[model samples]
Target: MSLDSATVRRIAALARIRVEDDELPRVQAEINGILGWIEQLQAVNTEGVEPMSGGSPVGQAQARLRPDAVTDGDRAEQVLANAPDRMGAWFGVPKVVE
Candidate 1:
């Protein structure tokens, strides 16, 4: 979808980006170019392409996983010793929400 100047300004505001009045036109053109490239990508034929979940493809060499074991257990006392506020076996922080 092509974006207008007003739409580009709205996008910048939504993203909390401060775009100067003079830079609006340049930003608008750049965003429009990106959208055009996306449109071109959407026009490609990929009816039989399978969706990939990660960077590596399926049936490829997988990363070796280490055995799950607790290497730093029984250190709760030491960990909580320097805590400003301790709640039983956990560190306590001020409640931010009601």
Candidate 2:
């Protein structure tokens, strides 16, 4: 599949890219080449291929299971003592932006 100049400009606009008039041909050709590669990839036959999780072969997986626990260690008061500028219950910092 080939991409035209208008489609390339639309794509550039949708992607928030600035494409000048003279660069449209190069951009359109590159997009057409990418589409052609995708078309070529679609022609490949994968009849009996099993989908693996995240491209890792299922046979080589060794995941360590851990317990899911939600417990606050009650260290909030202890940690807030080290703040140089502490408001009532929050840490204050100098403004870094104009």
Candidate 3:
């Protein structure tokens, strides 16, 4: 498909790109070049090629995560001790609403 001056102007307007009167031909030429390249790419024959995620044929298996183990980190008391204001085991803050 060939990109014409009108199509280029419409695309520029839609993309919010302001092309001056003199620059319209330049923009149109650039769009035609890009579309020409795309037309060349469309002629390639890829009959039985499976689409791979990372562009590589050898798909690497995802690494397994370690099973969740019940271990106590136990830093609650230490964190609470450094608070500016604490009531028993909870943080104390000034009332935000009247």
Candidate 4:
């Protein structure tokens, strides 16, 4: 899993990044260093280790949820409360990437 200059160039092309000829060696060494760290991590034994989410251990604490009591009131007013621009019932956001 070592990285070479050719592999670094290919990666830059695939990521749509422009790299100078002199920068290739530095990029290759950096990527190879990252790969070496990953290889070291892969050599560790995790036979009894379990996966956890968001820094919390499994089954350590329960998440709380609001009560499911249904009440419909001012649905339109609630939706338009913080809209920067609005036209009656609709929110007006600026056109994007046109």
Question: Across residues 19-74, which tens digit of lDDT does each residue of candidate 2 receive?
Answer: 99989999999999999999999999978886687678677756777778888868
Indicate which candidate wins on lDDT: 1
Compare candidates 3 and 4 on TM-score and give the better one.
4
RMSD of each: 7.6, 4.8, 7.7, 5.0
Per-residue lDDT for 3-63 in model 3, tens only?
Answer: 7788888999999999998999888888888888998988888788776776556576755
* Model 3, global lDDT: 0.85
Q: Which lDDT value does model 2 have at 2?
A: 79
lDDT of 4 by residue, 5-83 (tens): 8889999999998989988888888889999999999999989998787788887786788898888755988889899
What's the alpha carbon RMSD for model 4? 5.0
Error of 3 at 34 (Å): 0.6
List the candidates' TM-scores in order. Answer: 0.62, 0.61, 0.58, 0.61
Give the alpha carbon lDDT tens digit for every residue of 1-83 in model 1.
87888999999999999999999999999999999999999999999887765777677788899999979688999999999
Query: Clashing residue pairs, candidate 4?
Result: none
Q: Can you give the lDDT of residue 76 in candidate 2?
A: 69
Backbone clashes for every candidate come to 0, 0, 0, 0
In model 3, where do residues sit more than 4 Å from their true spots? 58-60, 63-98
- The TM-score, computed over Cα atoms with residue i paired to residue i, of candidate 4 is 0.61
